[model samples]
Target: MIKIVSFVMLIVVMLQGFTLESDYNRAHQKAMQSDKIFIIFLTEKECVACNKELMKIMNAKNVSSLIEKNAIFVVVYKEQKNTFPIEMLYTTQYPTLFFLDKNELFSCKALRGNIQPKELMNCLKLR
Candidate 1:
């Protein structure tokens, strides 16, 4: 009975930590280190262009590959979303890509519209 109880408890704890929201925060913290870059996705729910841009980024193999390796990817939903800081830091742009080096400085304007995977990959490399 004790063994089963412990196993169940472990499973519960692990499951709680598996969410994307939690993972995003953890990765964001790590990106503060010099070795990592942060690629933040600011999105609005009602924007058609934003949705299209997000789809492109999601399917972008090269961008995804680079992001998986050396960058922290954060998806922030704006326009009265629950995330206060994201709403404060960003605005109505449905899809915005904010790049930051390890120093967390604002590197460029929010990249909107459809983005090519290779272009995003090249941007990160330049960072």
Candidate 2:
């Protein structure tokens, strides 16, 4: 009985993690409707650094909570370039992070390359 209860609790906790939308248009729409910022994460499937950075972001509790409360998070892979914006094409780095304000404009400088959880929190506070 305890094991079953623990499993259920685990599932619930896992479900509380940040949700990454794949479609930029849909995510932007939702963000505008909610009056929240839009956060775009550009990554590549075969990039080890990107995967590691993503894992750090997801595992950071504070970062997850801040993102959930104030932003619409979206992940666009290299294979899904069609979903990305032309403005973002200038970036060739993996695991790039962009924060768009409520007006759908960039809130701050784009973060490229490897980023730690604390660095991510600092970036969020910038906007």
Candidates in order have lDDT scores of: 0.58, 0.76
Against the correct fold, how does model 2 do in TM-score?
0.80
Among all candidates shown, the one with the greatest lDDT: 2
Relative to the unseen true structure, what is the C-alpha lDDT of residue 13 in candidate 1, on a scale of 0 to 100? 32
Tens digits of per-residue lDDT for model 1, 1-127: 5346335534543343321222345556777753777777676655667656655565555655666676766655664334324433645444667776665666544566566666677767776
lDDT of each residue in 5-100, candidate 2, tens digit only: 335434543576666776888899899898888889887766768866766677778998888888888877767746556778777898899888
How far is each candidate from the true structure, as Cα RMSD in Å? 9.3, 6.4
Model 1, residue 67: distance off in Å is 1.1
Off by over 4 Å in 2: 1-16
